[model samples]
Target: MDKLEEITSDGVAVCQPGLRLGQLESEARKKGWELRMYPSTLVKASVGGFLAGGSGGIGSVAHGGLRDFDTVRAFEVVTMEKKPRVVLHEGPAVHEILHAWGTNGILTRIWFALTPAVEWMQLTAAFSTYEEAFQFAESIATGNTWTKRLATVFEWPIPSFFTPIKRLVRADKSLVLIMIAASQADALHAAAIAAGGEVTFTGAFDGPRTQPLLSDYTWNHTTLWAMKADPAYTYLQCGFSLTECREQFRKLRERYGQEILFHIEFMKNGDGVVIPGAIPLVRFSTEERLNDMIAFCRSIGVFVANPHVNYLEDGGRFRPDNIQLLAKQRYDPRGLLNPGKMISFRKQVVTK
Candidate 1:
């Protein structure tokens, strides 16, 4: 409350993580105000940074993506007039600022239309093969029901077949979980069946909700695995669609020759456009292959904007479309915030 009051009073950029969204939302609701919420973690991310960049969250697959939540609201922002401004804008105005990565005017405070919270039904589906696993993903992406949390595909390839196997092994395809929380668990289960998905679990998120039994450590955990038949390896993070997931799997095998470590949390993109289903990627290691791993991911069609951007893949939020665009025009006519960051067109701002 204090932080928010400070921003409302001074009108400066303020960012926070998902766990605190309730605080902001409640505050807005109390004063008949609103806000933009980035739905991930605050461990290493900032408020303006995440939502300002198109991040979603674990609940997106069923509830809708971050941008959906940011669709309506007021923005407390700084202006070029050498003073602050309270912009009561929606649609385009919101987009101008949302996910533009601060190229537009800086957002001191943001308010979003509150979504009705609901009781969630958590579930998962694990398959033996990537083909079977991904088949489930496609169906969920195109489903009509609103009872889904996430749809993921995991892999655990087998050992090198001939000491020189060409294609990656099945063992390389390990455990990937497509997590989802829905209004109706049974409906999601039926959809999973129609989609060729195998139900791994339902509700309770057994054994570490955040996974890895740790709060902060993300990415390939393979750096310090046991060399003696070390069943454990590092992981990598990638944002891809059901369609892109298969191709990416192929690329990982073809490019790096490294197999899937264990888990890939495949969630929904809500509307499945642009960022398309915020997918959670977990590679087991962070060794000397970070650069190569990232390059390989990009070459295969994934948008590698910012590391924090991926947090949205798990359910973080950002502002809407138009607002983000306007912010881009007024504040960063040069599009030089991060150069090739988020905002794509700025010369038109200059042209005007």
Candidate 2:
């Protein structure tokens, strides 16, 4: 099942869901193409698992999210029935199974949209202040001066937890990690200098290298590193208004100080406008304090995708999509798939 069945000339990858995202990427890169978006856990996460559970990562800076980029051309789902049926969904219909946590149907095959491969260079920029680091990331994300696959910023002490590349980074400096086109290296260097930052590290990221990749220090992996460093750290998945993110960051820093380490991933929204998504590492003292902090984030227009809760509705940043529920009813009528994860299923059952 973990096979890369085909790579078409038009840049589409037809593969089994069991294929690891990293393996798919490597195979596609060999064919001069690459996945539109992938999670930071690409090496270990399967194609189906990412489609079912992950929102976005890596290439999202240029391509937007998995849902937004029209990245999924089709899905082949296996329904849970007395006689299970193989179903193929195309175009907009694929969303029925996307990010649903496998509560609707099991994915067997996926046709993913791919882009022409670029020789991406991994680089890290160090800044004297967190604001400078963020502004540097913002310039690359919003401007066309440099094409980037990833742009992630870490505030002060957060960089301290990235021990693998600790020698390349200053302990006191905030950091901006990027995976940009090798062609734009000079432009990126100049831009970093203009932003009051310096490119601390730069290397070629050509799939499965000996050295540590900057990507491993990004997205949810930032939280992973922090947690490894100190078990007291948990994380919050959040979104900030594109226009108001600077002020929001200010407010969050003021509120939590060093207690909540700021880690931001700059990416394009569904509308192709760049926005900031956060996976801030929180110093976990109690469940009450974490809940209170989440409430406070919501109060300030910072959208919190509450990861603390298990229910689908509670964890998602957006309202429950009716498409997902309708799919569940059609594919898993008995509510046998994934059991209690989908709160909407239980509600629909009660209403009957």
Instruction: Go through the candidates in order and give the C-alpha RMSD of each one to the true structure.
Output: 9.6, 2.2
* Model 2 CA deviation exceeding 4 Å by range: 317-319, 347-352
Model 2 quality (TM-score) = 0.95
| Distance from true location, Cα of 170 in model 2, Å | 0.2
lDDT of 2 by residue, 258-302 (tens): 778889998888898888888999999999889988998999899
Clashes of 2: 0
lDDT of 1 by residue, 1-352 (tens): 2254323432222333232444554454344332322243423444555556545544455445455644334565554333445454455456555665555566665544443333444455545665666566656544655534444444443222112222222344332233343456687678666655556556543212333211111122212221223434433345664456667666666755544432343344435432233223334355446556666677777644435333222222234334444565666566555555543344543443
Give, for candidate 1, the lowest lDDT window spanning 10 residues.
213-222
Winner by TM-score? 2
lDDT of 2 at 291: 90
- The global C-alpha lDDT for each of the candidates, from Candidate 1 onward, is 0.45, 0.87
**Candidate 1 regions with alpha-carbon error over 4 angstroms:** 1-19, 22-38, 42-49, 62-64, 68-72, 80-89, 100-106, 157-183, 187-200, 204-245, 259-303, 306-352
